[model samples]
Target: MPLVAPVTVHKISGETLTEVPDLLAVEEPLEIRLGFGPITDRQQRSVSVTMRTPGHDEELAIGFLFSESIVQKPTDIISCRHCVQDSQKEGNVLRVELHPDVVMDWSRLERNTFTSSSCGLCGKTTIDAVMALTPGPLSADFSIEPAVLHALPERVRQTQRAFAYTGGIHAAALFDVDGKLLLVREDIGRHNALDKLIGAAFWQNWLPLSQFGVFLSGRIGVELVQKSWRAGVPMLAAVGAPSSLAVQMAKEAQMTLAGFVRDNRFNLYSEPDRVIIGQVMAFKA
Candidate 1:
């Protein structure tokens, strides 16, 4: 299905109302299921039911699994498929089968983990539990030029085909240390977009994202910070303000978090040692 849908909007200009055709980002519920055990004997469980953009459903499903630490690497998944044979369904259900012997905490997978565009830490019981999920303190010595950091939001925006068309979605893009756009995904929910990026990178065995960074189209939240940290990305930049939890988590993870990245300037929330402007200034993490 097409990622975007056409809709009618009423434009209001103080006293004038005009009907116009507009584009909207389509949001749908994607049921991510996990099937484990042998090829002949398997157990199925519904892990997450998330609201996401419809396209890239497989990527979304595997990405969600990876970011949530349900599966650590691409080889963990045996196969991924939508319930295409069920005529009663709209094909939103994605079942990911896992290789035998790959163990995960089944108890932690049962919460439904309902997340939204605005926040990703909805149902966690404690802050420490959330922090426990972050991969670890980063050890990458990579740095980005300030000009490279300043140009990221626009560069990421340039690849946001969905956001440019609909203006109603958030985006996440993964970039290498030298500021090359490696992968990009857009979704109504910010966390979902980042999940998709992380999942794709996992398939390529790109864990410990030591040489990479991420750019967000919306405000940085603790959840995004946590996901970026889990992926081992050294620098995280956004076009909006970050929350206190996000900054604090970034500091703990030793990840560079930058925000308000627009108009040729940006603010560094944590780990400023990774950004350079011709001179290598002394800084501590």
Candidate 2:
């Protein structure tokens, strides 16, 4: 069976019962373990246990490592493997092996009880926690026209295939200099979707996403800003509003943050200089 599927349920409300079809959200536990070289020098460390949809476990692991600063280059990772003792047991745990010299600082990650599809960022204690680990934003002189920002939400909406069917997944897409869609990834968790996109980019040998722009399907939160900065994305656009702290982080990173992008309109929260607003207006006029 595939990881996700749709089901119908009947509910009664005051003698009126109707069968409604709804998309089921898959929740599964995945434990990530890190192994560092040698049988005698082998040190196994448990990193994070994230509950995510089952597919793309390797991408999730690599994305986690990249976002956490555990590994810089792809060569830092020696190999990735998954093991399941029994199919009945939730045992698809992933183990990643990093180069012997790769240093890991586990202090940056917060211990969360359960990271669900919808509430991936809710477990965060404060913005300061994310800021401490988040690298400074891209210091590039890149700029995007407001017209390009206005056109993105519709383009992104059209690209989300899973969302078209389920309407329950989040998406993150990258666009090139000419505002062409480069890649997109959809997942139950917003952060995971972004991570999967970043992981895919890394797999394609496209690191430092400063030359491109990232468009998200939801609001820009602290976690979203942190992940974008870590990926070196110069500009981030969202279909919903951005948190105050997210704007602050964008300012610190010198990234252009725009939100509420819908219907040819958007709110530029920070670093307006990175947006060619006048050019868009001139073009419109």
Candidate 3:
């Protein structure tokens, strides 16, 4: 069993003592470095230094790059490797070398400090600052039923392995057009879970997930919507409600956004045309 170092409190009663475990919050620092070689006159930029869990650092880096729109194609990334300048110390820094022909949009590169789950949009300076770096609209034309959206929560709940253990993690899952779960990742932070999932897809060379849909175990926020947009996900569903800004961004990005999905009931916030209401269970009933 995977173990999380949880803080415990002990209480002594009149007869016996009791111990209770608290949420385990671990902080590990990871550095991200961009490499394009010295020949192209492109300087290696240290983009972000985030405090996160030690596991899945590479995937986190790749997902962060994709979400930031730094690289489009998987081929654009030559390699992602861990570097340790000294033998005695364990380095959490990742050096990502891009293809010689690939060029990064440095003007849009933001988020210079630490990113916490509580606030995924803090480093963003302005709306234009974020919109300027986002990728184009999704290419998929599939539709999902409101009933299917409603059934997502049950499916996600059953598939949460880490949550079952620690009861303190969030998850992001990829579902096919048929509503079958494809991939799921859990992390202490909702954004981290999505990052891990997107990073896994990029590692498999599965660029542009417009054909598939993304489901979140939490509320739909602007940052999450932007990440899905950058990944080319045509439709995004969430168990909780979506923020007003998230709904606006989804509509602007031409992506289907659904929320309040739970117990076979959900509301279509934007692009209802992508949702086949007639195909949903609620309509059939």
Question: Who wins the lDDT comparison?
Answer: 1
Stretches > 4 Å off in candidate 3: 1-3, 10-17, 21-25, 39-43, 85-91, 111-131, 279-285
> How many steric clashes between backbone atoms does each model show?
0, 1, 0
Q: Please report how far candidate 2 places residue 126 from its true position, in Å.
A: 6.5
Q: CA shift at 5, candidate 1, in angstroms?
A: 1.0
- Candidate 1 residue-wise lDDT, 1-285, digit = tens: 677999999999999999999999988888888899776778988888888888777887877787677887778989998875365556788889899878768766543233543545543342456557764588798888888877788888888888899989998898877789989999998888988888778877878788988999999977787678767888899999998878887888888999999999888888888887565568899
- Report the backbone clash tally of model 2: 1
For each candidate, the alpha-carbon lDDT, in order, equals: 0.81, 0.77, 0.76
RMSD of each: 3.6, 4.5, 4.6
In model 3, residue pairs whose N, Cα or C atoms come closer than 3 Å (at least 3 residues apart or on different chains), thus clashing, are none
Per-residue accuracy of model 2 over 1-285 as CA lDDT, tens digit each: 245687998988999999998766565777889998565688988787776766777887888778777778899888887866577644568889988887756554544211332554442344445555555446876787777888888888898776777777788899875678999877787787888788888877788887999999998877778788888888999999998777877887788898999988888888888786554443453
How many angstroms is residue 263 displaced in model 2 relative to the true structure, after the best TM-score fit?
A: 1.4
Better of 2 and 3 by TM-score: 2
Q: What are the TM-scores, per candidate, against the unseen true structure?
A: 0.89, 0.84, 0.81
Question: On residues 141-225, what C-alpha lDDT tens digit does candidate 3 reach at each position?
Answer: 7786566677778888899866765677788999987789998887777777788789888888886887899999999877788
